[model samples]
Target: MKLTISDLAKMTGLAKSTISGVLNNKDGFSEKTRQKVLQAAEQYGYVPNEIARGLSTKYTKTIGLVIKDIANPFYSKLTKGVQEVAGEYGYTVFLCSSFEDHHTEKEQIQAMLSRRVDGLIVAPLLEEVTFDHLFDLKAKSVPFVLLGSVPGLDSSYVEFDDYDGGRQVTEHLLERGHRSIGFAAGLPTSRASRERLRACRDVLSAHGLALRPEFTFEGAQELADGVEIGRKLIAMKERPSALICFDDVVALGVVKAFQSEGLRIPEEMSLTGFDDIDLMIFPLTTVSIPTYEAGKALARTLFGRIFGGPDTPPQRIVFDEKLVVRSSVRTAAN
Candidate 1:
């Protein structure tokens, strides 16, 4: 026994079209008529069907958000930021995890698009060079903002200053008199990873030193990967005096592995990490990226594109990363 707009119209003694206009908040309706319709609807406990309303207004009042990994604390903070802003605008967010897979990312994007979300915030797989799926989104005129670097794709995005962060950490290690350094890289296809590795190399080159190929390890995204890398480093006949990890998670795993092997941090080896996630109990030196602020910025930018008309210029915001020095790294013997 659900009440419909026609029932509301009959109850209010108004035309069905009048009832619809008033309920939808469309202009050209008198205040008295609007109030009457509202009162009637409230008396009947009528709830507007969102799907039906969307069909007429063309807005679902929902947005899609896709991130690399939901399990990552960085994205968790970022998602919180996005949800906070979305709540203020009376919009719901549909979150999806890409799991760092290109095919999965594309499928999730299509699913979100099929649901007719008002806009999207994506952290696309930067490992793959092709972005046909993103191009398709643009061709379909769907508003979206990227959360990370996607080289050659001229789109609205918010990214971290990974290069500078790399330099900061590398220079700090160098200033501590540690010339023999190692880099634990993330995905090789990631532009952020490449930029960070490049910065490390550049800084090392400036100091008349070079990162040894044998010491550089790639594909260290998870804790297990870091543990494996740590075991490999321990087995090495000649290990670097210090290591720079891709993220805090990996660094934590490495620290655990090193400690289990009776190696003391800073005294035996120094370590640094990026994306200073709160999960780490170890006082590891790392770069802190403002992931929550970046999320808020992404939502704000996406809304701007959604409501600011098609002519709204694309914006690219880059947040600088800060190096948080801690006891994990100490001055090396000259």
Candidate 2:
């Protein structure tokens, strides 16, 4: 049995409109009357219907967060940051994962819209350029902030300086006298991977060296991919002295594959990774991005659009990536 506003009004000897106004926190109700209605509602255990209220006010007090993969530690940290800020604003978050599938991403966005979420924070899939679902959201005037870059989207986004991060890694390797270097790329369509690869090439070009075409490995999205790449490198007649992986997970996989064959890290071959994930077993030389802080920024940017008017100019927040040197990379002998 549920207590309605009418029941609350009868219990407190007040008009139904008075009870409704007080419960909804609308203006014009006297403090005494407000307290009276609240006391009766509390005593009677009256719970307001959120769906009904949302219809009247057009504010659901909820938001949706869609990420690439929830199992990834980077997104996990990012989610915590978004939740912390959303909590402070009295908003509930509906989380969804695309699992790096474009069709699934479209379905998730449609589901969020059907639920009437106030806003959305999405980490768009960089694989395959079509974003008709996201464009539809724009046409519908829904507020959304992207977590990563999507070329020609013309939307608000939060991203790390992947190009600069790649430059740093390549420069560091060059400084360590590592001229023969290889790059293990992520999904071929990934913008981050492309930017990093561009940086590596640019830096190497400036040093009168070039990334060998055969040295570049692509389509590394999982640990198994890294293991396969590792085996390929081992069988090569001449392999690069160092390898820069797309991310920490792939780097870890490569490390595992190498160790299984008695290959010592930074001794026989050096390796580095991006998005320095917290892994105790491997002290990888990688680029560290402030993933948690980036998540908070994504939510904050979305809320700004939600409350600060839709006319607010789109914001592009870019966080810097730091290169953390560890035992995985070493100076090459001249």
Each prediction's whole-model lDDT (CA): 0.89, 0.89
Candidate 2: which pairs clash? none
Per-residue alpha-carbon lDDT of model 1 for 1-334, expressed as tens digits? 8788888878888899998888778999888998998888888899878887788788999999998888878889999999999999999999999888889999999999899999999987775458999978777889999977565667789999999999999999999999999999988656677788999999999999999999899988888889888889889989899999988888988998888898889788899999888777899999999999999999999999999977788899999999999988889996
Score residue 10 of candidate 1 by CA lDDT: 82
RMSD of 2: 1.8
Write model 2 residue lDDT over 1-334, tens digit each, in one string.
Answer: 7778888888889999999988878999899999999888888789998887888888999999998778878889999999999999999999999887888988999999999999999988776658788777787889999887666778889999999999999999999989999999988656678889999999999999999989999989878888988888888989899999988878888998898988889998999999988763688889998999998999999999999877989899999999999888888995
Q: Indicate the TM-score of model 2.
A: 0.94
Screening candidate 1 with a backbone cut-off below 3 angstroms (N, C-alpha, C), the clashing residue pairs are: none
Model 1 segments more than 4 A misplaced: 26-32
